[model samples]
Target: MVNSVPDCDFTADYLTATEADNLLAHCLTALPWQQEDILLFGRTVAQPRLQVWMGEPDAVYRYSGTDFVPVPWDAQIRALCTRLARDCGTRFNSVLCNLYQHGQHSMGWHADDEPELGPEPVIASLSLGHARRFVLRPRAKGNPDRHEWSLGHGDLLVMRGQTQQHWLHGIPKTRRAVGPRVNLTFRRLLGAEVSAGRAESAEIDVG
Candidate 1:
């Protein structure tokens, strides 16, 4: 509970900083043949991208109204998920891994609301390596509505409750000084298909 935010049941810990770093080093070295960078707004963005896959055979990840086949998991990743779940005070089934090479590499404005996420899905995020600004803004119109913080190596962020419904979060690209960072967001998609057409839609990797 080192970096616990106010009114946020979530807790961010640096307890396993060293271990996380060690695991990340191994991941960088052995995560199969690298995944191709996906196009984002026609920029063909690179690092800070993703590989949406499921852990179980029946597990399927739905992102941006699309489905995806999860890549196979290794021991290190499985251990990471276990640790993150215990730290976040919730359970997780799938993990979305992100590789951010530099300060310029970042995620944009968006909420994890794929309809498949259900109402108020719980999201546990783990950061390894470089530190960057993590910002959250209220979805509703408001004058003073910007919340930002720096998440360094080993920090864990758990967002729950009405967070997804009321706010949108992102890791904006910055020209500031930084190094490579890898983040894994663990999520649980309770077997519920909100719509029928969604099940047939092509899985689009719009990073």
Candidate 2:
């Protein structure tokens, strides 16, 4: 799928110095140190998030085939999750945070299309610190038109239903002098395989 692109929720919010600092403070204090993998290029990346599970207790995603255990919520984390959900006009009980220390850190192109997320999943994303470009390309089976946006500090990018299924998204590298950056995404998930015993699961194994 790479032909048509959806209407862009590709947006960013410029923050006053204080506002950016405040969010960064919460993320640093509240978020756990994330373990990450090198993307397509084998570069280092960090994603701190709670685990999420769907379907049967051992059920794994068709895409990543991962089973995870959720991280207990920190006070700041809970507050951020709640606020983001309210702002995006959606409800989310979990969040994934990515931390990039310098220009070299980045993520490869991919879609959050796992089955557990249910069809047409909703994502609420918040960015802090250095500004970075987030590129999105149509993956409509045979299309190639691409769209891009710069996610500035304190910016919020909300990806809605159909957004993930139709396209791939990623953070590209930059040569400009940029400080550390953090991103938070909130989403809700449920599936037939998930039961009370196996939730709070998340895994980031890219095939």
Model 2 agreement with the true structure over 1-207: per-residue lDDT tens digits: 333656456555544667778878877666665453322223333442222221123332232222354566666656767776666677675666678777777766677766667778888777887788888776555666777778888887887768777777888767788888888777776653443222212222321
Report the lDDT of model 2 for residue 131. Answer: 83
> How would you encode candidate 1's per-residue C-alpha lDDT over 77-123 as one tens digit per residue?
88877876776667777777777777666676667766667777888
> What is the TM-score of each predicted model, taking all chains together?
0.77, 0.73
lDDT of all predictions: 0.65, 0.62
What's the lDDT for candidate 2?
0.62
Q: Report the C-alpha displacement of residue 95, candidate 1, in angstroms.
A: 0.2
**Model 2 per-residue lDDT at 170:** 80
Query: Residue 44 lDDT in model 1?
Result: 45
